[model samples]
Target: MSDKVVKRPFVNNNCIGCGACIQVAPNYFDYNKEYLSEAKKCETYNEQDVNNAISVCPVDAISWI
Candidate 1:
């Protein structure tokens, strides 16, 4: 077997769509017309993307766990 790791994230109710996370990391974070933050699926990004989200989350809603 392999030891590959995968991560998936999504926008929760707390998402205010401030676009801060997207500005820090565009490869993963994005905003809708309403300006809400969105995270890619678990297998869509690496650790870097997740960290960016966590760091940019003003509400502390983004977490690895």
Candidate 2:
């Protein structure tokens, strides 16, 4: 048996466009037309940065899966 580490980040409808996640990890997060935070598409990963963003979100919108 082995433990799996999930690194992909997800944003829910609760996003308030606070830009906290964008400030913490710009490479992973961006603002849509609605100004909500959304994940960017890329292969290079940064779990620590993403986690930092998740921690700072005021509405608890960002999460890892």
Candidate 3:
């Protein structure tokens, strides 16, 4: 198997204040003053959890870089 690395999660401009990411991975995401979901200050290197959060985003605003 090739060793691939999952990048950290990031919120994009498409965010619609949905809480799906937060619900799926609270440790990696939080809401900002604009009610938009954003990545938490601490890096959540857990690829699975981050991917789960990305998958649940209704707006598909979450991505990795």
Candidate 4:
């Protein structure tokens, strides 16, 4: 029952695992086994936080699909 969005966010290969995304949106972003930032949840509940994470990405990796 996930009210998924048409364009969910994702962390691309360009991610440097800076953990900024996690810091910005802990409920959505997390570190993988590779120590990289990955999207734990793609839901668009608090878009402002997500946008903040996207903007803070040093490598501009996070995006919508």
Candidate 5:
């Protein structure tokens, strides 16, 4: 296997106050007072959490690269 890790895209505007990201990666994401998920900036990828977030997103706004 190649030494590669896909990165997940964070769209601040596209986010629709969804808590899915937070549910999947509680360490990486959290909900604001308005119930919107606050995406954190990290150097490395959380593979399992990212995948789970992608699967959980209702609007398909989270993109993986």
Candidate 6:
């Protein structure tokens, strides 16, 4: 198997419902029922794409796992 680790975005409970990340990278994130930001599941994205979203998160809730 390839050693390339599939990096997925994760939004922690510290999210403040800010859409900054979504605006920066909609493909990697979305809003939950509680209006909080959550990472889209079951998908792999480029590091740059995920990093853009993470950089825009004011609450620093987004990360890679």
Identify the leading candidate in terms of lDDT. 2
| lDDT (CA) per prediction | 0.70, 0.87, 0.84, 0.83, 0.70, 0.83
Over 6-25, each residue of candidate 1 has an lDDT whose tens digit, in order, gives 54666676887777788877
Worst 10 residues of 5 by lDDT: 1-10
Model 6 CA deviation exceeding 4 Å by range:
1-5
Models, CA RMSD each: 2.5, 3.3, 3.4, 2.6, 3.3, 1.7
Tens digits of per-residue lDDT for model 5, 1-65: 35455465464656797687877787767776776776667766678887788778887767664
| lDDT by residue for model 6 (12-63), tens | 9999997999898888788999999888875457788788888878888988
| Displacement of the residue 63 alpha carbon in candidate 2, Å | 0.7
lDDT of 2 by residue, 1-65 (tens): 23344468899999999999999999999999898999887665577898899999999998886
Error of 2 at 1 (Å): 20
* Candidate 6 local distance difference test against the native: 0.83
Report the error of model 4 at residue 45, Å.
3.1
Write candidate 3's Cα lDDT for 1-65 as tens digits: 24555467889999998798899899989999999998986633578889899888888898888
Q: Count the backbone clashes (under 3 Å) in each candidate.
A: 5, 0, 0, 0, 0, 0
- Candidate 5 residues lying further than 4 Å off, grouped into runs, are 1-6, 32-35
Q: Candidate 1 has what TM-score?
A: 0.69
RMSD of 3: 3.4
Error of 2 at 30 (Å): 0.4
Worst ten in a row by lDDT for model 1: 1-10
**Which structure is stronger by TM-score: 2 or 6?**
6
Index of the highest-TM-score prediction: 6
Off by over 4 Å in 3: 1-6
The TM-score of candidate 6 is 0.85
Residue 36 displacement (Å), model 6: 0.5
